[model samples]
Target chain A: MYWNADLECVPLEQRRELQLERLKSLVRRVYENVPHYQRVFREAGLRPDDILTLDDLAKLPFTTKDDLRRTYPFGLFATPLRNTVRVHASSGTTGKPTVVGYTRQDVDIWSEVMARTLTCAGVTQDDIIQIAYGYGLFTGGLGVHYGAEKLGATVIPVSVGNTKRQIMLMQDFGTTVLACTPSYALHLAEVLEESRVDRTRIRLRVGVFGAEPWTKQMGRELESKLNIVAIDIFGLSEIIGPGVASECLYNTGLHIFDDHFLPEVIDPVTGKQLPPGEEGELVITTLTKEAFPLIRYRTRDITKLYEEPCPCGRTHVRMSKILGRTDDMLIVRGVNVFPSQVESVLLEIGQTEPHYLLVVDRRGPLDQLEVWVEVSDKVFADEVRHLETLEKTIQRELESTLGIGVKVKLVEPKTIERSQGKAKRVVDKRDLYNRDK
Target chain B: MWVKQISVFLENKSGRLAAVTRLLADHGFNIRALSIADTSDFGILRLIVNDPAHANRVLKEAGFTVSETEVLAVEVPDRPGGLARVLDLLHQAGINIEYLYAFVSKAGENALVLMKVEDLQRAVDVLSAQGITIQGHDVVHQI
Candidate 1:
């Protein structure tokens, strides 16, 4: 077996000590094997022995996305290529792909973590889990697949697309657990409603969704539409896969596998770690990852961490859903704007879909914000004047919500490009320095 | 039987017109006649080009949103009364002229007046039966 399930039943204090011991040995192994970690450690003039306890982890040098970009492909892997069983990469839309490697042992650990996550979500051996995340290059599909199999549940590797067939399988095959991104799950619910399929007739009872940040309103909307309990599963390809953390039946916050992955919130600009309940960029350090052990890797995701014990009897650390990426912030006319803020406002409007594009450009000395919103056919008549009025309404709502005036452009339905993977929500065209020269 | 014209939306910004004209020059499309209708915000630049179809496609591919419409192209003698006779026929037919611009044909025997009429087919028939030639081309090559 990949994991000792008995560890879940063990005392929390004992698990921490065992994890610390394992982390120390893993740190020593990486120091000897990985050149990048060795140079980083040596540059800080720190030895592996200096990290005696988990608290001493702050002394280690932090890993940034720029570091990952610098070591593009397999430069960060601690193990040789022959030992790596699988390789997954993040969609490097801005640049090259950020690659991650997993050894056989690392894969086993990942499966165990995912299994624990699914079990906490109440998925059992009797359930048929449909994995709907896109497979290949992206880690969501295969990550959830292994976890469901590890839980002794029948795994249906129904990689994303063909929504009609997906729903048919759910109805015919008696699928109980659905794994997909939250946006796609909502899209499927919309599709189900359109097809007039009786939502209650489906056997789906629970859903595990992640890979993108979704609001609580979205969760409630999906729950009402599908009549299934929606849970969040959080992970990145840089860290293990989609099962590194997951929400329990409580649905409050996602429980991190603190024994394997140490979570820290740090000021993104200063690199200073923050206390619990303080929102900042999340930093993660691997405790037992053998192939690619990262120490204090800056995730750029903004969220708060809490260590309070959950009602589910797990003492793992809980992290709120990510608010937004620090890099995704847009400066419109000297006022900072986040796309998530726009999304929240759109959700409040209750008529627009989550699809929106932030078009930023400079008009003379002032920055212009044009929000291209896709309107459904039912809500909008096919007339230019009506669209203009609707646009004004959206603009007014956004101004009140964000405290910044913005122009809204109501686009036709299906105008925005549907992304098969990560969605590109922002397009900024203002470059004053380049323009002046 | 057919006449084509190009209408370009020009923003009130520096070098905007130069960019559009330069693109046409590079593509070897010659401007037969052009007119500009302007407001404070933007200008509608209408053109009677040597080749409208090719010009429209080229301008569109270069990221300019371009559309086409039919206009009456009347061949009037290079004299005053020849122009007055065709306008009289259109007036008698109750076809309103929104706006128009005239260009001297390269042959110089006749002048071509591009007319934006309320009814295109009726104007074409009215001018043709009155013994005035309607200069509509299927294809006009670059000069």
Candidate 2:
């Protein structure tokens, strides 16, 4: 069995040779095993032998989200269901959730990737890892859960919610490393301060957050609150889970596990591949996944790909933090708006709950957006006039941040629907077909 | 003396007024007089409509956050001094006007003024005793 090494740290010539060899084997496996790949290759009128190097990767058919959804359930799994040890799914906002499976070997490889990520972040056996992400079909909680266990760190699988208990566990257990979504981490920090808990006394040193696209401003806020180093972890359930790549302590781009997953940047509109340092959609192909292998799956996440060696000495390809999903982009009154843009503005206006909903609808020929924000009791006294003033302030801030006018409705705290699992932040009521009419 | 009064909660957005108008139209109701008491985010769209109960149900069914309120619709002369007389009466009675709007009556000689006051019953009693003709619920529906 050939084991993959961190070839990016090795000499440039050696890394290129290794990548070329892996690329050739990956193409052969897809052509020989996957029926979809075979049909695509036949339609393209190209033989598997034509793709013998990394340069030939362009010849392969690009997989997309539509393909994954059309397959549904498990039509794309390369191995039998019995061989699969784990399954994870994305929230089915548009349609049926995309299901992904992993065999025993695949799970081992996932843990190994996460272990490398944690090790790169300076986490060791002496660290106590607190996993705050939710468990179950969602991969974030358990992905970090097992990865910490594999690294011989004391794992606290305290899933999401119950911030009071999470804070208690952090203080009592002396959690040195935290893994969670960035929003929840900030919520925890808020709860900690409200409860008069000294943030430094908890002894948290490092945090790995993902599962939602967060900005650098948010990362800095989280770092300042918890007095810990915050790093971004990147992955998707279709490709793997939370441990596909992670940022080092340097807080640059996340390093990809190029040995098992091939990363590429492509123009979202034309599907043409872009060169390094250019912003585009991140595409990945599972090189060694046996259970639910994906070939050149187009992730709608927008980011840039970098091939330059990081200061941390990892030869793995690097990806910048994802800005937003192309599918989630909202066009309100002929202007584009991302939920993260709203989130950034909310963060700056301290003492506000992160829970918010974007209501999009068309009024006559013009599109309108209303942001329902949950008001914190400290800022407003729950009176109608006070809440209204807060709403105006939110509207002004959002207009300044997004450069588009939006009406802000101040809802009572917890009035917005809470997500038991993956949160649905956007509620678009615009009729796309009628808009043209 | 009573007038048909209807209250509706409206979030501040463009075309929201159109939505309210369409709902009332679909229910075969017509606005007699209307006033909007607003804060920044939302407004209470108070109205004296053709049918209060029917308008309220239609607004609710249309998913608009709405409520019903009893406002006073005082009849005044079509002249400019007519509104001033009613305002002077209310001010003397210590009644605070939250908001008010005028309606074009069919007779053209008399105008209907919809008034939302802090105290509904007290204002009605004060206006009725002052010889100001309070339009009945039937006259409101007839409009």
DockQ of each: 0.05, 0.09
Categorize the docking of model 1.
incorrect
In candidate 2, stretches whose alpha carbon ends up further than 4 angstroms from where it belongs are A1-8, A198-200, A329-437, B1-9, B12-143
* Model 1 lDDT tens row, A22-83: 77887788889888889999999999999898788778889876787788877888999999
| Fraction of native Cα contacts reproduced by each candidate | 0.00, 0.05
lDDT per residue (tens digit) for residues B1-143 in model 1: 76777776555567768988999999987887778765443455777778788998898677554557677777788876988888889999999988888864543577778888878989888888888887666532222
User: Which of the numbered candidates is closest to the native, going by highest lDDT?
Assistant: 1
Once superposed on the true structure, which residue ranges of model 1 sit more than 4 Å away at CA? A1-6, A9-12, A329-437, B1-143
Clashes of each: 0, 2
Among all windows of 10 consecutive residues in model 2 chain B, the one with the lowest summed lDDT is: B62-71
What lDDT is reached at residue A381 by model 1? Answer: 31
Q: Report the alpha-carbon TM-score of model 2 versus the true structure.
A: 0.64
